[model samples]
Target chain A: MSLAASPAPAFTLYDYVLSGNCYKIRLAAALLGVPYDSIAVDFYPGFEHRSEAMLALNPAGTLPVMKTADGVVLTETNAMLAWLGLNHDPGGRWYPAADPVRGPRLVEAMSFGAGLTGSVGLARLHAMLDWPVDGAAARRAGKRDLRQLELRLTAMQIDGEDWLAGGTAPSMADLACFPYVALSPDAGLDHDGYPAIRSWLYRVRSLPGFVTMPGIHDLHELR
Target chain B: MSLAASPAPAFTLYDYVLSGNCYKIRLAAALLGVPYDSIAVDFYPGFEHRSEAMLALNPAGTLPVMKTADGVVLTETNAMLAWLGLNHDPGGRWYPAADPVRGPRLVEAMSFGAGLTGSVGLARLHAMLDWPVDGAAARRAGKRDLRQLELRLTAMQIDGEDWLAGGTAPSMADLACFPYVALSPDAGLDHDGYPAIRSWLYRVRSLPGFVTMPGIHDLHELR
Candidate 1:
C-alpha cells in the first residue's frame, strides 16, 4: 500500500532531447532522483523552441525550460542545475557553495560554465544545424575553454582531487560543463590535446545514475 | 578604531569603467558597502584585456575580474554577483534565493540574467567598441528581451511587486538585470515602448546606495 505523503514532485521538462541544455536537466533528475514528465520540443530543423507554445513557456525562446507541478518555470540551464543541486542533493556533493572551503572554487567553475562554455555550445550548434556562424572563431574559443578546463583539472589531479570545484566530489560545476565538452567533437573540435579533461569527462560519465543523449555516449575517454 | 583581530576586506576590482559587466561588480560592492580598489583596465582602444598580463589573470579575457585581499579572483559577472549575494549579504534582501518562498522566483530571475539579458550586452559591445557584428539581429533580440522584462514587471506592478524576483526589495536578480537594460540605448535600443521597465530602472537608481555609470543617470525615467 502507498503511504500518505506530502506534495508530489510534479515536474514537466520542455525538453529537446538532442539539445545539451535539455539533457542537462534530464541528467540532473537522473542523478538526484527527481522524477518528472518530459515534453519533447522540435528543436532542430523544426525550430519548435521558437514556436508560440514554447514562447508561452519561455518568452525568450531559451530552452530546457521546466514547469514544476506547482507552476514554477525555469529557463536557464545553469540556474536549473543550481536549483536541483541546492534543493535536492542531500549528500551536498552537487551544490558545494554552502561549504566555505569549496565556495570560491565553485563560483569560478560557475563563471566558466555561464560564459566560456557557451562558445562550445554555439560552435556545436553551427556544426550540427547548418546555422550560419563564424565556425572557426567559435571553435577557437571552444578550444580555449577546453584548455582552460584542462589546465585547472591537471592541477586538481596533481593535488589528488578529481572534480572541477577543487572538491573531492562533483558539484554543479562538473554537471554544467560536462555535456558540451564531451560533445565538442561534433563541432569539429576535440580534446585530444587535453588529457586531464579527457579523464575528467570519463569520471563524469561514471557518475552514479548518469544518462546520455544522441551525440555523446557514456564512456570514459581516458583511464 | 581599526580592528586588530580580523583581517580587513582587501578587494581590488580590475575594472573597465564603461563596461556594464564591470559596472555590475562595482554596483554590488557599493550597495553592499564592500570597499575595493579599482584597477582600471584599458579595455577599449588599447585592448588591454587581451594583453599578456590580463591573460595571466583571466585566460578567457573577460573583464570585471576581481581580486580579494586574500587573493581570490573572480571573472564572470553573474558568478561574482552570486558570490557577493551568498557571502556578504547578511541582510538577506539582495540574495532572496536563500528564502524558500522566494527561491523559485529568484531562479527564474537568474535565468533571465544568464541568457536573455546577454543580447543587450552583446549589442552594446557592437555599437560602442567598434566591434563588427550583426547589429540588426542583436538589437532585435535585445528589444525582444526588453519587451519580455516589461511584460513581467508590468504585471508585477499590478500585483504590487516592484522587484524583478517578485520580492519587496532588490535582490541579485534586480541588480543582475538592471545595468544592461538601463544601458540599452547605447546599443541603439530604447525603452520608449516599455514604460514599466523605465520605472523599474528608476526604482533601481533610487536604491539607497545605488551608484551610476556614465550613461544611465540616478533619476527615475517615470517621475
Candidate 2:
C-alpha cells in the first residue's frame, strides 16, 4: 500500500474494519494518497461505538467518525468522503462533476447508497456481526436495489459511459455505492444477474490508487 | 399558496401529497417562493410509482421524482432539496456555512434523515398506507432516532442556533430532516421526549414562505 509522503495526514478516523461506511473513508484516503490514523472501534460484539467516548465524539453513535486536522468532527462516511474530495483534493479530481447536473446525480447515488447500506449491509450484519436483520425483507430489498443499479449501469454503458456520476472520472458516487455492493454476497444476494455492476466494480478497483477491505478484492493484488 | 411570478419555474415534481419526501420539495419551493407544476404519483395501493412511466423517470421506483428545467431527472428527496438549494437560491441563503465543515454536517443530517425515514417514517406507513412494518422494532428505533435528534438540536440550540446545519437561516438539511420527524406521532412515537427537536420544528415552520403537509400543522395557522 502506498503511504503518505511527508507529514502525517491530519485526519483521524474512528473506524471499524467490517463496516462498509468506514471502508469508504479508508478507500477515499487511500485513493487520494492521503494517510490517516485509524482507531478501530469494536462494532460487532463489543458494540463500543455506543460507549461514552464515542458518543461524545458523535452522539449518533455511528461508525467511521472522522476528526479532521482542524479538529472538526464528522460522522456519516459519505459526508467524510465528500469533505475529503472537496477540501483535500486541490485539483478536485475525485469530485469531477460539473455541477447542476453531475452534482445532483452524485447526490442521488449517495442517497441510494444509504438505502443499499440499510438493506444489503444490514443483511450482512445478521451473518457476520450477530445482528439479526429481517432476512427475507432485506434480501428482497437488496435484490431490488441490485437490479436498479444494474439498470443504471446498463443505461450508462449504452450511453458509452463507465463511471456513475462524472463523465470519465470516478467520483464519490462510485465509492459511496461500492463497498456494500461488493460485499452484498454476505447479504445473500446472488451476483450472477448483475453483469454491468460487476464490470463497474472492476473499473473502480482498477482506478489509479484504489484500496480494499476483507470482502472487496483489490484488483492489483489479485493479479 | 404563493405562486411563482411570470415565466414559470421550469421544474416539474412528480409528487404524492402524503409523502414526506414529496413535501420536502414543496417546502423548499415554498420557502424559496419558487413554484413548480406538481404531477401527483399515486404511491399508495395504486403504486403507480412503479409503473413503466415512473420507472422510466426513475428506475429506483422512488417518489418525488423531479424533472428540472434542463430536463435532468432526480429521485432522491434530499438530493432534490440540495439541488434546488444549490441552483435556485442565487444568494446561497439555503446552503449556509462554509465548505469542509457545514457541508459534511449537512450530509450527516441527510444520512440521519434516511435513518429517521426508515424508523419513524416507516412506522407511519404501517397505519396510513397499510405497510406492514416491524412495529415494535420500528417504534424502538424511532424513539432512539428522536432522542438523537433531540440531543443534536439541544446542542445546536445551546450553541445559539435555531436551525439544524446553518447558523441561523434554515437550510436544506433542516428541510430534509423535518417532515418525517414532525410527523413522527403518526408512527406512534411520542413527542414528549424531543422538546428541542420540537422547538426546532416550530422555528422551521415560522420561517418565511414555510409550507406544511397534512400532519405537519402550520404554526402561524395555529396561532
Candidate 3:
C-alpha cells in the first residue's frame, strides 16, 4: 500500500468475510494497494449490525464502512469504491474521473449495478439459503432480471465500447457490476444464454489488478 | 426549458409522473433550466419497460433516458442528474463541480435515495394500487419492507444531517428521495411516527427550483 507522502491515513474496513458486497471494497483496496485494518461484523449474531456503534458509523446499518485517518466514515459499497478510485489513485484512471462525454453512462451502469445486481443478489439469497424469498416466485423475478441483464450486455457490445463508459480503461462501473454478473448462474441464470454478457464478464475478470470474490467457500472455508 | 446554444438535443425521458425515480432527472432539468421531451411509459402494460426499444436505451429498462444531440443516451437518474448539473450548468453550483469533500456524501445520499425511496415506492405499488407484484409472496414482503423503511427513517432522523448528506444547500440526493418519501403515506405508511423524516420531506419540498410532479388527471401530468 502506498503511503500518502503527507501522512499515513488511519484506514479500516468493517466487513463480513463472505460478503461480495463487502468484497467490492476489499477488491478496490487491493487493486489500489491502500492499507487498512478489517473488522468483521457478525450479521448472524441476531442483527449485531443494529448495535449503537455500527449505527453511529452507518445509519443504513450496512457493512463495508471505510474509516479515513481524518475520521470520516464512508458507507455504501459503490460510494466507497468511487472515493478510493478517485481520491487515492495516482493515475486517476481506476474509474473515469467523470468525463463530459461518458459520465452519464457511468451513472447508468451504477444504477443497474444497484438495481439489477441487487435483484440477482436477492435471488441467490433465496436460492441458496432458503431465506424469506418466495420459492418459484423468486426464480420468476430472476428470469425477468436476467433478460434485462442480457439486453444491457448486448447494448454495451453493440455500442462497441471496449469497457463500460470508457474505452480501454476500466472504471468503477465495471468493478461494481462484475461480481454479481460473475455469480449469475448461482441465482439460476445461464451465462450461455447471454454470450455477450459472458464475454464482458471474462473481460472484467482478466483485468490486470482483478480479484475474485473470496472463492464462494471462503465464508465457510476461511474460518 | 432553456434553449440550447445550437440545435436541441435528442432527449427522451421514459417516465411515470407519480414516480420519484423519474422525478430525479426532471428536478435537475428544472434547476438547470434544460428542456427535455417526455415520453410517457405505461407501467401497467405489464412492465412496459421490458419492451425492446426501452431496453435498447437502458438494458435494465429504467426510466429517464437523456439522449444527447449527438446520439449518446444517458440512463440512471442520479448519474443523469449529476452529468447535467455538472456539464450544463454555467455556474456549476448545482453539483458543486469540483469539491471532492462533498461529492462522496452526495453519492451516498443518492444510494440511500434509491433503496430508501424505493421501499416507499414499493409500498405504494403493493398497498395502494394493490398491484400483483411478480413475487407472489410480495404482500407479506411489503410489510417486512415497511418495517425496514421505518427503521431507515428513524435512523435518518437520528443522524440529523441537514439536507440528507450535509450542509444547508440541497443536492440531487434530496431531489431523488423527495417524491416517494413525500407520497409514502398514500402507500399507507404513517409518517406521524417519523417526525424527522416528515420534516425532511418538507425541507425537500421547499427547495427553490423544485417542481411538483404532475397530477394524474392532467394530460401532461405524466410528463
* Candidate 1: pairs in clash: none
lDDT tens string, model 1, B1-223? 9666643664788898998878888898889987668889999888999999999998778798877676767776766776777677777567665443465566567557655446888888888885787877888889888888889998899989999878688887888788889899999897789989878888889888988998787665435
State each model's TM-score restricted to chain B.
0.90, 0.93, 0.75
Residue A152 accuracy (lDDT) in model 3: 61
DockQ values per model: 0.37, 0.51, 0.44
10 residues in a row with least lDDT, candidate 2 chain B: B95-104
- Tens-digit per-residue lDDT, A1-223, candidate 2: 8875676776999988889989999888888878788899998788899999998898778888999988888887777887888777888767643375677777778778867777888788876765766777777878888988998899899878888884787888899999999999887786788999989988988888787889877786647
lDDT of 3 by residue, A96-215 (tens): 635666666676676667665457777776766676866566666667766666676676667677677656677777777766666667777767787777677777666666666643
Q: Candidates sorted by DockQ, descending order?
A: 2, 3, 1
TM-score of each prediction: 0.89, 0.91, 0.80
Which residue pairs show collisions in model 2? Answer: none
C-alpha local distance difference test of each model: 0.78, 0.81, 0.67
For residues A54-125, could you state the per-residue lDDT of candidate 1 as single tens digits?
Answer: 888787787889787767677777667766776677775687654534665665676576554468888988
lDDT accuracy of residue A146 in candidate 1: 86
Candidate 2: regions farther than 4 A off: A1-6, A96-98, A220-223, B1-5, B96-98
Candidates 1 and 2 compared: the better one by lDDT is 2
